[model samples]
Target: MPFENICIFGAGALGGTIAAKLAASGNVDATISVVARGAHLDAIRRSGISLFEAGADKPLLANVTATNDPTELPPQDLIITGLKGHQLAPAAEGLAHLLKPSTRVVMILNGIPWWYFHRDESNHAELQFEELDPGGKLWRLIGPERVIGCVAIQGAEVSDPGQIRLSNKGRFILGEPSGDISADLREIEALLNRAEISVTLSERIRDDIWSKLMGNASFNPISALTRSRMSDLMADGATSDQIGKVMKEVKAVGEALGANVGISVEERLEQASQVGPIKTSMLQDLLAGKPLEITPLVGMIVALGRLTAVPTPVSETILALVSQLDRENCRTA
Candidate 1:
């Protein structure tokens, strides 16, 4: 089940990094096409994607098929989304053009995904979060059966339109929501590993999602509201303590829903502090006048907390402030 026709949709920062790596590797024999827009698409079409890795003497150029129109591409074997949680629904219609009956969509998103409860074994099975997928568009169009959940542990940013700056080389955790180790999952994992991209297969991807969300649900909004970098937030005792409280609340909610976070608040904070002075994506988007990812990152947590009857007073407070802040930013933008 080799994926010959692969597409990277919304090739921004993280998506661009994955696309560049796959195209440059020359190990995975597949046609890597990118669906992007604006100056980034133009530059990629002109000179391919330029990847500036940390401590690299020169940039790595990955030549691939670049286009903004999904309709132009043929049916794909795999479509790895690089868009944020908030960006997926709007592109669902265009994305469908690349899907066939067997196409597997790798959702590399932050926070809770739209298919979170799709095949759940619990009472919340098939529950939809409007905050994450307003109007059930993604659920209806993309189909959860086609979803392969992924948590990207890497940090990257579009330094320029066609240039992606790699902050760190991190691995990806991928799995099926049904907790099955299907052949499709293995094939996709092998494909990614062949491209020199590190990947870990998980049987329980929901736990992995919740583990990652513990930090994202806490750090992203806090960073946006305070306009502080990871190091700065972890440096101040007061701010660090506040972040811990929020993380604990998020943890409590996840635990209520049978998710094991596997790490303590102190350990998570220490890990984040080691990342130096990198700004969270939410903070970056706010500074750049883009729509904040409040719904998936923060709003969903509060919603889930209520669903599980967990007291998330701290998360609720932060959600309120950030939601309004996002509104102001959107209005101005």
Candidate 2:
């Protein structure tokens, strides 16, 4: 069977987009389920999953299953955990009983994944960064075997619980966490492609993830701390230079950890420059009075520096600045 019953762990912006496309493809036989709670759940259940199909001004609604309790959902073939970083633990908690042996969980979160380099024969292989998976809850519950790493470059946000505004790029890079091709990976790629979303099946998924992380770790926190946009930050020579330092640190850490990301620091910076000025998701979270995904986004880089015996001068500095801002943001709100 080709994954007829799929359940999304979160019913926010990204989940809605994926649900709409997957439903449209006729890949799955039944209605897709969106696991949610309270107002978000109510809105989705009552109004259906809505998205800007191909960036249209209006939303395209698809009939979907939305609910608060996972127990109410059947054991599904696929479960994509489209959650904020902080929501990982809770999602896992709910998932313990909801997933079956056949279900493959696609972890589509940003920043350093908890299972990176887990089975590699490198120096930093098998070293689990406790800062990201502090209690090892995610690591233990969701094994490396079931995970497919996603380098999600798309940008969309829930304009409200009922609708999601598709604002920018919708492409994502996918790979098995162990960097090996398998049946599940192929199935997912086919489903995504059938749904009209751009996906690249990557061999070096970790490197692609690290590349995006370098920009995210440096740019996201810096933007939030200074309240600036991408163009202004990339335009100023000094700021851009600071970002370069952070990327250098990221490269050093990745190299020491035995994951060879073969991109020069300046090349990475140039790639980030071409993306144009866009507001980061972290800033959106802050303005929405939600907890920032600081630990996984920026903290894991600093944590990796310590694990790999590398000096992270720039990442450390940026982490400190962002940490202070996050603390203040939490304190007042």
Candidate 3:
């Protein structure tokens, strides 16, 4: 059955755009709502969510119910979290009340998710990063079985409070942690496809997660540090060399976890360079004074390397620098 009540939690740039697309699809058969705060929430409540895709003259609109309080809302059949990795913790307690027994949570964020190591067969449960989730709050609250992995490859940002501008085109890869396809997964695929958004189901979601993380963990921090675009990062031999080294370390970490990324460093760099002068989400966040999503994008890779006895010196250095920069930004905020 199609999901009935849906909530797009953390209705920021990517979240708002996805919500708008699904709600405006006219075939989803779901009541779409969004949990957002501040001016964005007010704007969405007033005028719905606005999206301007590439090459669009005007904007696409989707009238979704917007709220800051999830407790007052009905239980959701599906909860799509669009928050950054660092923003998940504070919102977890509130979201716990919104989940019914059969509710599914699709986390569409970049980097290593909090549930990455939940059901691994290895004896590395002790290696779970407390920094990502202190006291395993999200894992215990939401339960890994209800969690679905999503690798979102699109670049989007909020031009204003209620406006989302999506640049380029990309696809979403969704899968269960156990590498099995289920009815709900197929339903999600159908919903996104109907909206004219690309979606795919993966047998091994972790491999795809690592595949995207390899690039995110490599380019995002370097872009923030250098204040450079993707083209600039790829053009400089030294900068691109650092990205390649970091990606190699990430590949080793993924392999140690039994998920091969299956792509060469050169190929990844070439593909990224072709994206032109696009600014990474990390760099955008830094410039906007928002909290840098360093933990999952960069820190988790470093932590996983430590667990697997692989060295990630390049990523580690980038993590330390970007983290300090984030701390300084927060200090003045």
> Would you list the C-alpha lDDT of every candidate in the order shown?
0.89, 0.77, 0.87
Q: Tell me the tens digit of each residue's lDDT in model 3 across 165-197.
A: 888776788998877799889988887798788
Clashes of each: 0, 0, 0
Model 3 per-residue lDDT at 82: 93
lDDT of 1 by residue, 1-333 (tens): 868899999899889988998999878888999999989999999999999987676899999999988999999999999999999999999888888999999999988899998888888999987768779888888899999999989888788889988788788999999999999999998888888888999998888888888889888999999999999988988988989998898888888888888888888888888998888899989998889888887888788888998888988999899989999998998
On TM-score, who's better, 1 or 3? Answer: 1
Model 3 regions more than 4 Å off: 125-127
- Model 2: colliding residue pairs: none
TM-score of each: 0.97, 0.92, 0.96
| The candidate that achieves the highest lDDT relative to the unseen native structure | 1
* Lowest-sum lDDT 10-residue window in model 2: 22-31
What shift in Å separates residue 317 of candidate 1 from its native position after superposition? 1.4
User: Which candidate would rank higher by lDDT, 1 or 2?
Assistant: 1
lDDT of 3: 0.87
TM-score winner, 1 or 2: 1
Write down the worst ten-residue block by lDDT for model 1: 128-137
lDDT by residue for model 2 over 27-61, one digit each (tens)?
A: 54655887877676788778776787544876677
Better of 2 and 3 by TM-score: 3
